[model samples]
Target: MSKQHEKLRMMLTAALFAAIIGIMAQVTIPLPLVPITGQTLAVGLAATILGSRYGALSAIIYMLLGAVGIPVFSGMSAGMGVIFGPTGGYIVSFIFSAFITGLYIEKTSATVTQAFIANAIGMLINLTFGTVWLKVMADLSWAEAFVGGFTPFIIGGILKAFLAAWIGILARKRLQSARLLPSSTKLSA
Candidate 1:
């Protein structure tokens, strides 16, 4: 493909992943503090497939959409209020999670094992950021934050990480075979 076409394809793919994150954010299981959502899964998948640059681009686009009142956040909430709200840390963490996850896989290989490790780290980052933000924003003690925002999501996070790893690697391999995805080196370039 021409360079222009490749760039356009990557851009469109990032946009599509951004939409996927928005849609996944609606899969919420409510809790006292943070709700469980599929946003992290989508984040993992994007990074595993697109690597650091496009993956982080997808997250940035997703956040920008929500920040501008696009109703793309959890519970369909939008605007800067959601970005600066109690749950905003989780939202903000997606960028780092995606970037780091993709960077890990890029530096290594897009194998299931590497992806799982990367996703697990991403999950930890997400949880840590969210818990601390919840504590500060909600004026809760660390214990309360751990209980309300951290502990409840551990099991679910693990499952999501594994799922993202398995599914992401599988899909990435298929896309590469079909020439729909560029190689990691090409992506970095």
Candidate 2:
């Protein structure tokens, strides 16, 4: 593909990923601090598929859209206030999680095991950011923050990570078979 075409493809991919994240945010299970949303899966998939820069860009786009009052966030809420709310940390975490996960997948190449590792690490980063943000935002103790936010989502997060990793592996296989992705050596470099 020509340079222009490649750029267009990347932009399209980023938009698609952003849309997926936005849609996933709408699918939520209510909880105390932050609700459970399918966004983690979307983030993992974006990272696995698009690599670091594009994955991060996609997340940035999602945040920007939500911040601009698109109601793309969980509970269909938006604005800078949301970013500073209890769930704000989780939102911020998406950027790092996608970037790190994508970097891991891109460097190691996507395999079931590698995807699992990447997703796990990425989720950890998310939790870290989220928990800290929640504590500060809500003025809660560590235990309270854990109970209100992190603890409730552990099992779900694991399951989602596994699911995302599995899907990522399958997608990678399909892309490779279809010659959509570059070879491993080229991707690694």
Candidate 3:
């Protein structure tokens, strides 16, 4: 493909991925403060597939849409205030999670198992930021914060990570077959 065509394809793909992530957020199984949603899985998958720049741009696009009052967040909530709310930290963490995961996946060599591990680390980053924000907002101790905001999501996160990694592997293979990715960009785990 031409350079312009490739750039356009990447942009459109990023936007589509952001939209998918937003949709996944709405298919939530509510907990207490934080809901169990497939958004993290989508985020990880986008990162793994799109690379760091595009992945982070996709997340930023999602956040911007939500900030503009798009009903894209969990429970269909949106706007700047919602982002600054108790769960805001988690939303913000998506940017870093996507960026870090993409960076690692792009730079390091990793198998499916290693990719899953990277996904887990990314989720932990989200939990850490989210738990801290929850503590401040809820005025709870660390233990309380963890129980309320992080613990309940552990199983779901693990499941999502595994799924994301698996999907990533599949997508990578397909891309390789299609010659979408240059061999020089390959990473080994």
Candidate 4:
């Protein structure tokens, strides 16, 4: 494909992944402090498939949409209020999580194992930021934060990581085969 065409494709794909993250954010299981949502999984998938640059772009687009009151956040919540709310840390961390996850994949390969490790690390990053933010934003003790933010999500995070890894790697391979994605060199571009 032409260079211009490839760039367009990447931009469109990033937008699409942003939409996917918004949609997935609706898959929420309510909790006292931070609800478990599919947002992290979507972030992982974006990273694994789109690589660092586009993956981070997808997260940035998602955040911008939510900040602008697009109702794209979990529970259909939107606005800068959500961005500054107790759960805001997770939202902000999505950009970093996607970038790091994609960076790991780009540095190695998009195999399931590598993706799983990368996603797991991303999950930790999400939980850490979220827990700390929850503690401060919610005025909770460290134990409370650990219980409400960290402990409850560990198993679920692992499952989501594995799922993201498996599904992301599979989808990425198909996208590459269909010529919907650029070559490895272009992935980091």
TM-scores for the candidates: 0.96, 0.93, 0.91, 0.97
Candidates in descending lDDT order: 4, 1, 2, 3
What clash pairs does model 3 have?
109-188, 109-189, 110-188, 110-189
Pairs with backbone N, CA or C atoms under 3 Å apart (clashes), candidate 4 = none
TM-score of 4: 0.97
> Per-residue CA lDDT of candidate 2, range 1-189, in tens?
565665576677788899999999989988756789998889888887777787888999999999999998998889999998888999889999999988888788578888888999999899888998999999999999988888888888888889888997788678767766544512321
So what's the TM-score on candidate 3?
0.91
Greater-lDDT candidate between 1 and 2: 1
Q: Per model, state how many residue pairs clash.
A: 0, 0, 4, 0
- lDDT per residue (tens digit) for residues 1-189 in model 3: 666767777788889889988999988888867788888999988877776777778899999999999989998889998888888889899999988887777777545776787789889988889899988877889999999899898888899889888898678668767866433443221
lDDT (Cα, tens digit) per residue for candidate 4, span 1-189: 888888999999999999999999999999878899999999999999998899999999999999999999999999998989888999999999999999988888879999999999999999999889989998999999989999999999999999999999999999988889985623946
Q: Which stretch of 10 consecutive residues in model 1 shows the poorest summed lDDT?
A: 180-189
Per-residue lDDT, model 4, residue 24, is 99
Task: List candidate 2 segments past 4 Å from native.
Answer: 179-189
Comparing candidate 1 with candidate 4, which one achieves the higher lDDT? 4
Decreasing TM-score order of the candidates: 4, 1, 2, 3
Poorest 10 consecutive residues by lDDT, candidate 4: 180-189
The whole-model lDDT of each prediction reads 0.90, 0.84, 0.82, 0.92
